[model samples]
Target: MAGNPQGHQEGAAGAARPVGVLALQGDFREHVSVLRGLGAEVVTVRRPEEAAAISGLVIPGGESSVMDKLSRAFGVAEALKRRIAEGMPVYGTCAGLIMLADRIVDGIRGQESLGGLDVAVRRNAFGGQTESFEAELSVPVLGDPPMHAIFIRAPVVAELGPGATALATLDDGTVVAVEQGNLLGTSFHPEMTADYRFHQYFLQKVAGFDNGTARSSRP
Candidate 1:
Protein backbone atom coordinates (compact mmCIF):
# COMPACT_ATOMS: atom_id res chain seq x y z
CA MET A 1 0.00 0.00 0.00
CA ALA A 2 1.25 3.49 -0.82
CA GLY A 3 1.36 5.65 2.27
CA ASN A 4 -0.19 9.07 2.40
CA PRO A 5 1.97 12.19 2.74
CA GLN A 6 1.58 11.87 6.48
CA GLY A 7 3.31 8.44 6.25
CA HIS A 8 0.24 6.47 7.41
CA GLN A 9 -1.09 3.81 5.10
CA GLU A 10 -4.87 3.31 4.96
CA GLY A 11 -7.21 0.67 3.67
CA ALA A 12 -10.35 0.97 1.58
CA ALA A 13 -12.42 2.06 4.58
CA GLY A 14 -9.70 4.54 5.58
CA ALA A 15 -8.44 2.42 8.48
CA ALA A 16 -4.69 2.05 8.89
CA ARG A 17 -3.20 -0.87 7.00
CA PRO A 18 -2.64 -3.85 9.23
CA VAL A 19 0.76 -4.91 10.54
CA GLY A 20 1.16 -8.69 10.44
CA VAL A 21 2.45 -11.09 13.08
CA LEU A 22 3.85 -14.33 11.76
CA ALA A 23 1.42 -16.66 13.54
CA LEU A 24 2.59 -20.03 12.25
CA GLN A 25 4.53 -20.63 15.46
CA GLY A 26 5.63 -18.35 18.31
CA ASP A 27 4.47 -15.97 21.03
CA PHE A 28 2.57 -14.10 18.36
CA ARG A 29 -0.45 -13.25 20.47
CA GLU A 30 1.69 -11.16 22.82
CA HIS A 31 3.01 -9.19 19.86
CA VAL A 32 -0.50 -8.65 18.54
CA SER A 33 -1.56 -7.30 21.93
CA VAL A 34 1.41 -4.90 22.03
CA LEU A 35 0.90 -3.64 18.49
CA ARG A 36 -2.80 -3.06 19.06
CA GLY A 37 -1.97 -1.26 22.29
CA LEU A 38 0.28 0.99 20.18
CA GLY A 39 -2.73 1.84 17.96
CA ALA A 40 -1.69 -0.16 14.90
CA GLU A 41 -4.00 -2.57 13.14
CA VAL A 42 -2.63 -6.08 13.59
CA VAL A 43 -3.20 -9.27 11.63
CA THR A 44 -2.10 -12.83 12.43
CA VAL A 45 -0.41 -14.21 9.34
CA ARG A 46 -0.53 -17.97 8.71
CA ARG A 47 -0.78 -18.12 4.94
CA PRO A 48 0.82 -16.63 1.86
CA GLU A 49 -2.05 -14.26 1.14
CA GLU A 50 -1.86 -12.86 4.66
CA ALA A 51 1.91 -12.47 4.31
CA ALA A 52 1.41 -10.50 1.11
CA ALA A 53 -1.07 -8.05 2.59
CA ILE A 54 0.85 -6.49 5.45
CA SER A 55 2.93 -3.30 5.30
CA GLY A 56 5.14 -4.77 8.01
CA LEU A 57 5.54 -8.06 9.93
CA VAL A 58 6.72 -9.15 13.36
CA ILE A 59 8.25 -12.56 13.88
CA PRO A 60 7.99 -13.47 17.56
CA GLY A 61 10.03 -15.54 19.99
CA GLY A 62 9.65 -19.32 19.91
CA GLU A 63 11.45 -22.33 18.39
CA SER A 64 13.22 -20.97 15.33
CA SER A 65 13.50 -24.37 13.67
CA VAL A 66 9.83 -25.04 14.22
CA MET A 67 8.92 -21.64 12.80
CA ASP A 68 11.09 -22.31 9.77
CA LYS A 69 9.50 -25.68 9.15
CA LEU A 70 5.96 -24.41 9.56
CA SER A 71 6.48 -21.35 7.39
CA ARG A 72 7.76 -23.50 4.55
CA ALA A 73 4.99 -26.06 5.06
CA PHE A 74 2.36 -23.34 4.99
CA GLY A 75 3.99 -21.73 1.90
CA VAL A 76 4.53 -18.48 3.73
CA ALA A 77 8.31 -18.67 3.96
CA GLU A 78 8.98 -17.85 0.34
CA ALA A 79 6.38 -15.13 0.41
CA LEU A 80 8.04 -13.54 3.43
CA LYS A 81 11.49 -13.69 1.87
CA ARG A 82 10.15 -11.97 -1.19
CA ARG A 83 8.53 -9.30 0.92
CA ILE A 84 11.79 -8.73 2.79
CA ALA A 85 13.66 -8.40 -0.48
CA GLU A 86 11.03 -5.94 -1.61
CA GLY A 87 11.75 -3.67 1.38
CA MET A 88 8.95 -4.52 3.78
CA PRO A 89 9.76 -3.65 7.37
CA VAL A 90 10.11 -6.62 9.74
CA TYR A 91 10.95 -6.89 13.43
CA GLY A 92 12.05 -10.25 14.75
CA THR A 93 12.63 -11.16 18.38
CA CYS A 94 14.54 -14.07 20.00
CA ALA A 95 13.91 -17.14 17.87
CA GLY A 96 12.55 -14.73 15.34
CA LEU A 97 15.99 -13.15 15.27
CA ILE A 98 17.53 -16.45 14.32
CA MET A 99 15.13 -16.82 11.42
CA LEU A 100 16.22 -13.51 9.95
CA ALA A 101 19.93 -14.09 10.19
CA ASP A 102 21.86 -14.84 7.03
CA ARG A 103 24.10 -17.35 8.79
CA ILE A 104 22.93 -19.57 11.62
CA VAL A 105 26.01 -20.77 13.54
CA ASP A 106 24.25 -23.57 15.40
CA GLY A 107 21.08 -24.36 13.53
CA ILE A 108 19.81 -27.91 13.56
CA ARG A 109 20.72 -30.12 10.63
CA GLY A 110 18.50 -29.33 7.65
CA GLN A 111 17.19 -26.18 9.32
CA GLU A 112 16.75 -23.08 7.15
CA SER A 113 16.28 -19.38 7.84
CA LEU A 114 14.46 -16.79 5.72
CA GLY A 115 17.76 -14.89 5.56
CA GLY A 116 17.90 -11.12 5.20
CA LEU A 117 19.91 -9.59 7.98
CA ASP A 118 23.61 -9.86 7.21
CA VAL A 119 24.73 -11.50 10.39
CA ALA A 120 25.58 -14.83 11.94
CA VAL A 121 23.54 -15.88 14.97
CA ARG A 122 24.23 -18.60 17.47
CA ARG A 123 21.07 -20.25 18.73
CA ASN A 124 20.70 -20.46 22.49
CA ALA A 125 23.89 -18.48 22.98
CA PHE A 126 23.07 -17.97 26.65
CA GLY A 127 22.56 -21.68 27.33
CA GLY A 128 18.95 -22.85 27.87
CA GLN A 129 15.66 -21.42 29.13
CA THR A 130 16.77 -21.96 32.72
CA GLU A 131 19.72 -19.71 32.00
CA SER A 132 17.55 -16.89 30.75
CA PHE A 133 18.14 -13.51 32.37
CA GLU A 134 17.34 -9.83 32.12
CA ALA A 135 19.73 -6.98 31.44
CA GLU A 136 19.61 -3.24 30.99
CA LEU A 137 21.03 -2.57 27.53
CA SER A 138 22.38 0.59 25.95
CA VAL A 139 20.60 1.16 22.69
CA PRO A 140 21.56 4.57 21.35
CA VAL A 141 18.79 4.47 18.79
CA LEU A 142 16.21 4.30 21.56
CA GLY A 143 18.26 6.74 23.66
CA ASP A 144 18.19 7.78 27.37
CA PRO A 145 17.69 5.24 30.19
CA PRO A 146 18.74 1.79 29.16
CA MET A 147 16.14 -0.69 27.95
CA HIS A 148 15.31 -3.49 30.36
CA ALA A 149 15.62 -6.53 28.10
CA ILE A 150 14.42 -10.05 28.81
CA PHE A 151 16.39 -12.81 27.17
CA ILE A 152 14.95 -16.32 27.01
CA ARG A 153 16.66 -18.99 24.97
CA ALA A 154 17.91 -16.03 22.96
CA PRO A 155 20.34 -16.09 20.06
CA VAL A 156 23.33 -13.77 20.01
CA VAL A 157 24.70 -12.05 16.95
CA ALA A 158 27.97 -13.86 16.42
CA GLU A 159 29.11 -11.80 13.46
CA LEU A 160 27.49 -8.65 12.17
CA GLY A 161 28.35 -7.99 8.53
CA PRO A 162 28.87 -4.61 6.93
CA GLY A 163 25.24 -4.46 5.87
CA ALA A 164 23.93 -4.35 9.44
CA THR A 165 24.43 -2.15 12.48
CA ALA A 166 24.36 -3.18 16.13
CA LEU A 167 21.75 -1.24 18.04
CA ALA A 168 22.24 -2.59 21.54
CA THR A 169 24.57 -4.85 23.43
CA LEU A 170 25.22 -6.19 26.90
CA ASP A 171 27.96 -4.59 28.98
CA ASP A 172 30.04 -7.66 28.19
CA GLY A 173 29.86 -6.67 24.49
CA THR A 174 27.50 -9.39 23.33
CA VAL A 175 25.33 -8.07 20.53
CA VAL A 176 21.64 -8.31 21.36
CA ALA A 177 19.89 -5.98 18.98
CA VAL A 178 20.54 -5.14 15.32
CA GLU A 179 19.09 -3.07 12.52
CA GLN A 180 19.55 -3.23 8.75
CA GLY A 181 17.53 -0.81 6.75
CA ASN A 182 13.97 -2.13 7.03
CA LEU A 183 14.86 -5.22 9.07
CA LEU A 184 15.25 -5.19 12.87
CA GLY A 185 16.02 -8.16 15.13
CA THR A 186 16.62 -8.61 18.82
CA SER A 187 17.92 -11.42 20.94
CA PHE A 188 15.31 -10.66 23.61
CA HIS A 189 11.54 -10.51 23.94
CA PRO A 190 10.32 -6.92 24.13
CA GLU A 191 6.71 -8.15 24.19
CA MET A 192 7.41 -9.99 27.44
CA THR A 193 8.08 -6.62 29.08
CA ALA A 194 6.18 -3.34 29.35
CA ASP A 195 8.51 -1.40 27.02
CA TYR A 196 7.02 -0.65 23.60
CA ARG A 197 9.69 1.60 22.11
CA PHE A 198 11.05 -1.16 19.87
CA HIS A 199 7.60 -1.79 18.43
CA GLN A 200 7.05 1.92 17.94
CA TYR A 201 10.45 2.19 16.29
CA PHE A 202 9.55 -0.61 13.90
CA LEU A 203 6.25 1.04 13.00
CA GLN A 204 8.21 4.13 11.98
CA LYS A 205 10.22 1.92 9.62
CA VAL A 206 6.97 0.53 8.25
CA ALA A 207 5.67 4.01 7.68
CA GLY A 208 8.90 4.94 5.92
CA PHE A 209 8.71 1.91 3.66
CA ASP A 210 5.06 2.52 2.82
CA ASN A 211 5.91 6.11 1.98
CA GLY A 212 8.75 4.89 -0.32
CA THR A 213 11.47 6.42 1.82
CA ALA A 214 13.01 3.31 3.40
CA ARG A 215 16.33 1.99 2.14
CA SER A 216 16.66 -1.76 1.53
CA SER A 217 19.78 -3.65 2.59
CA ARG A 218 18.76 -7.15 1.56
CA PRO A 219 21.63 -9.57 1.07
Candidate 2:
Protein backbone atom coordinates (compact mmCIF):
# COMPACT_ATOMS: atom_id res chain seq x y z
CA MET A 1 0.00 0.00 0.00
CA ALA A 2 1.29 3.44 -0.88
CA GLY A 3 1.54 6.19 1.72
CA ASN A 4 -0.63 9.28 1.67
CA PRO A 5 1.61 12.31 1.90
CA GLN A 6 -1.47 14.46 1.25
CA GLY A 7 -2.96 13.20 4.52
CA HIS A 8 -0.56 15.40 6.40
CA GLN A 9 -2.43 18.15 8.30
CA GLU A 10 0.46 20.45 9.07
CA GLY A 11 2.68 21.87 6.35
CA ALA A 12 4.77 24.83 5.38
CA ALA A 13 4.79 26.67 2.08
CA GLY A 14 7.50 25.47 -0.28
CA ALA A 15 8.31 22.57 2.04
CA ALA A 16 11.40 20.82 0.80
CA ARG A 17 10.05 17.31 1.35
CA PRO A 18 7.56 15.46 3.49
CA VAL A 19 9.48 13.68 6.22
CA GLY A 20 7.81 10.97 8.27
CA VAL A 21 8.49 10.16 11.90
CA LEU A 22 7.83 6.58 12.96
CA ALA A 23 5.18 7.27 15.57
CA LEU A 24 4.67 3.81 16.96
CA GLN A 25 6.63 4.79 20.07
CA GLY A 26 9.37 7.23 21.01
CA ASP A 27 10.09 10.89 21.28
CA PHE A 28 8.44 11.35 17.89
CA ARG A 29 6.75 14.66 18.64
CA GLU A 30 10.07 16.31 19.24
CA HIS A 31 11.30 15.20 15.84
CA VAL A 32 8.11 16.38 14.19
CA SER A 33 8.47 19.79 15.83
CA VAL A 34 12.05 20.12 14.64
CA LEU A 35 11.20 19.15 11.08
CA ARG A 36 8.30 21.57 10.97
CA GLY A 37 10.51 24.31 12.35
CA LEU A 38 12.82 23.70 9.41
CA GLY A 39 9.95 24.41 7.02
CA ALA A 40 9.40 20.82 6.03
CA GLU A 41 6.08 19.01 5.87
CA VAL A 42 5.82 16.56 8.78
CA VAL A 43 3.84 13.34 8.95
CA THR A 44 3.44 10.87 11.78
CA VAL A 45 3.93 7.45 10.27
CA ARG A 46 2.28 4.52 12.08
CA ARG A 47 1.61 1.95 9.39
CA PRO A 48 3.79 0.60 6.63
CA GLU A 49 1.50 2.19 4.04
CA GLU A 50 2.42 5.59 5.42
CA ALA A 51 6.10 4.92 4.65
CA ALA A 52 5.63 5.12 0.92
CA ALA A 53 4.83 8.73 0.05
CA ILE A 54 7.32 10.50 2.27
CA SER A 55 10.66 11.55 0.80
CA GLY A 56 12.47 10.45 3.95
CA LEU A 57 11.88 8.94 7.39
CA VAL A 58 13.05 9.74 10.90
CA ILE A 59 13.19 7.02 13.54
CA PRO A 60 13.37 8.75 16.90
CA GLY A 61 15.03 7.79 20.16
CA GLY A 62 13.19 5.11 22.09
CA GLU A 63 13.49 1.54 23.29
CA SER A 64 15.08 -0.25 20.36
CA SER A 65 13.48 -3.58 21.23
CA VAL A 66 10.01 -2.12 21.58
CA MET A 67 10.34 -0.07 18.39
CA ASP A 68 11.47 -3.20 16.58
CA LYS A 69 8.46 -5.20 17.70
CA LEU A 70 6.05 -2.39 16.89
CA SER A 71 7.52 -1.85 13.46
CA ARG A 72 7.11 -5.52 12.67
CA ALA A 73 3.61 -5.72 14.14
CA PHE A 74 2.49 -2.73 12.11
CA GLY A 75 4.15 -4.14 8.96
CA VAL A 76 6.23 -0.99 8.73
CA ALA A 77 9.42 -2.98 9.04
CA GLU A 78 9.14 -4.69 5.67
CA ALA A 79 7.87 -1.53 4.04
CA LEU A 80 10.75 0.45 5.47
CA LYS A 81 13.25 -2.14 4.24
CA ARG A 82 11.85 -1.85 0.73
CA ARG A 83 11.92 1.94 0.66
CA ILE A 84 15.42 2.04 2.08
CA ALA A 85 16.51 -0.55 -0.46
CA GLU A 86 15.15 1.74 -3.15
CA GLY A 87 17.42 4.52 -1.85
CA MET A 88 14.98 6.46 0.30
CA PRO A 89 16.65 8.87 2.67
CA VAL A 90 16.52 8.02 6.40
CA TYR A 91 17.83 9.59 9.59
CA GLY A 92 17.85 7.64 12.84
CA THR A 93 18.61 8.89 16.34
CA CYS A 94 19.54 6.76 19.39
CA ALA A 95 17.33 3.69 19.19
CA GLY A 96 16.72 4.76 15.63
CA LEU A 97 20.43 4.40 15.10
CA ILE A 98 20.20 0.90 16.53
CA MET A 99 17.45 0.06 14.05
CA LEU A 100 19.57 1.04 11.07
CA ALA A 101 22.63 -0.75 12.23
CA ASP A 102 23.55 -3.96 10.45
CA ARG A 103 24.43 -5.59 13.75
CA ILE A 104 23.86 -4.79 17.39
CA VAL A 105 25.85 -6.14 20.28
CA ASP A 106 24.23 -6.93 23.63
CA GLY A 107 20.82 -6.50 22.04
CA ILE A 108 17.89 -8.37 23.51
CA ARG A 109 17.30 -11.91 22.36
CA GLY A 110 15.29 -11.97 19.12
CA GLN A 111 15.51 -8.20 18.84
CA GLU A 112 15.45 -7.38 15.14
CA SER A 113 16.58 -4.30 13.24
CA LEU A 114 15.75 -2.72 9.86
CA GLY A 115 19.42 -2.72 8.93
CA GLY A 116 20.94 -0.35 6.34
CA LEU A 117 24.02 1.19 7.87
CA ASP A 118 27.07 -1.06 7.78
CA VAL A 119 28.10 -0.67 11.34
CA ALA A 120 28.03 -2.56 14.64
CA VAL A 121 26.57 -0.86 17.69
CA ARG A 122 26.61 -1.87 21.34
CA ARG A 123 23.38 -0.94 23.07
CA ASN A 124 23.61 1.25 26.17
CA ALA A 125 27.33 1.36 25.85
CA PHE A 126 27.27 4.71 27.55
CA GLY A 127 25.72 3.08 30.63
CA GLY A 128 22.28 3.61 32.20
CA GLN A 129 20.33 6.82 32.77
CA THR A 130 22.56 7.72 35.69
CA GLU A 131 25.46 7.63 33.29
CA SER A 132 23.80 9.79 30.65
CA PHE A 133 25.96 12.75 29.79
CA GLU A 134 26.56 15.52 27.27
CA ALA A 135 29.55 16.59 25.25
CA GLU A 136 30.61 19.08 22.60
CA LEU A 137 31.50 17.49 19.28
CA SER A 138 33.17 19.02 16.28
CA VAL A 139 31.09 17.82 13.37
CA PRO A 140 32.77 19.45 10.39
CA VAL A 141 29.97 18.44 8.05
CA LEU A 142 27.66 20.69 10.00
CA GLY A 143 30.39 23.33 10.26
CA ASP A 144 32.40 24.44 13.30
CA PRO A 145 31.15 25.80 16.67
CA PRO A 146 30.76 22.27 18.04
CA MET A 147 27.47 20.40 18.25
CA HIS A 148 26.23 19.57 21.73
CA ALA A 149 25.34 15.87 21.94
CA ILE A 150 23.22 14.34 24.69
CA PHE A 151 23.47 10.68 25.54
CA ILE A 152 20.70 8.87 27.41
CA ARG A 153 21.60 5.24 27.81
CA ALA A 154 22.89 5.63 24.26
CA PRO A 155 24.67 3.01 22.22
CA VAL A 156 28.03 3.52 20.57
CA VAL A 157 29.17 2.38 17.15
CA ALA A 158 31.89 -0.03 18.07
CA GLU A 159 33.09 -0.54 14.54
CA LEU A 160 32.40 0.63 11.02
CA GLY A 161 32.31 -1.45 7.89
CA PRO A 162 34.23 -0.44 4.80
CA GLY A 163 31.37 1.71 3.49
CA ALA A 164 30.61 3.65 6.69
CA THR A 165 31.92 7.18 7.26
CA ALA A 166 32.29 8.55 10.75
CA LEU A 167 30.75 12.01 11.05
CA ALA A 168 31.23 12.77 14.75
CA THR A 169 33.20 11.29 17.57
CA LEU A 170 33.99 11.77 21.23
CA ASP A 171 37.15 13.60 22.24
CA ASP A 172 38.66 10.21 22.97
CA GLY A 173 37.78 9.04 19.41
CA THR A 174 34.62 7.02 20.05
CA VAL A 175 32.29 7.11 17.06
CA VAL A 176 28.99 8.85 17.82
CA ALA A 177 27.62 9.60 14.38
CA VAL A 178 27.97 8.11 10.93
CA GLU A 179 26.55 8.10 7.42
CA GLN A 180 26.20 5.54 4.70
CA GLY A 181 24.71 6.17 1.29
CA ASN A 182 21.33 7.90 1.82
CA LEU A 183 21.18 7.02 5.53
CA LEU A 184 22.38 9.00 8.54
CA GLY A 185 22.62 7.62 12.09
CA THR A 186 23.44 9.34 15.36
CA SER A 187 23.77 8.12 18.90
CA PHE A 188 22.72 11.49 20.32
CA HIS A 189 19.39 13.32 20.39
CA PRO A 190 19.51 16.14 17.85
CA GLU A 191 15.74 16.61 18.06
CA MET A 192 15.81 17.19 21.80
CA THR A 193 18.00 20.26 21.25
CA ALA A 194 17.38 23.59 19.51
CA ASP A 195 20.00 23.11 16.80
CA TYR A 196 18.57 22.27 13.42
CA ARG A 197 21.78 21.96 11.49
CA PHE A 198 21.80 18.15 11.64
CA HIS A 199 18.29 17.93 10.25
CA GLN A 200 19.11 20.52 7.58
CA TYR A 201 22.21 18.55 6.69
CA PHE A 202 20.07 15.43 6.33
CA LEU A 203 17.86 17.36 3.93
CA GLN A 204 20.81 18.70 1.98
CA LYS A 205 22.83 15.50 2.03
CA VAL A 206 20.59 12.46 2.33
CA ALA A 207 17.02 13.58 1.47
CA GLY A 208 18.05 15.44 -1.67
CA PHE A 209 17.95 19.11 -2.52
CA ASP A 210 14.98 21.46 -2.71
CA ASN A 211 14.78 20.79 -6.46
CA GLY A 212 14.03 17.14 -5.72
CA THR A 213 17.42 15.85 -6.78
CA ALA A 214 20.08 14.24 -4.63
CA ARG A 215 22.84 16.64 -3.69
CA SER A 216 26.30 15.92 -5.04
CA SER A 217 28.54 14.61 -2.30
CA ARG A 218 30.86 17.07 -0.66
CA PRO A 219 34.40 16.90 -1.96
Candidate closest to the true structure, highest lDDT: 1
Q: What shift in Å separates residue 24 of candidate 2 from its native position after superposition?
A: 1.0
Candidate 1, position 200, lDDT: 86
| Model 1 lDDT tens row, 84-114 | 9988889999999999999999899999999
The C-alpha lDDT values of all candidates are 0.89, 0.82
Backbone collision tally, model 2? 0
* Model 2 C-alpha lDDT versus the unseen true structure: 0.82
Question: How many residue pairs collide in each prediction?
Answer: 0, 0
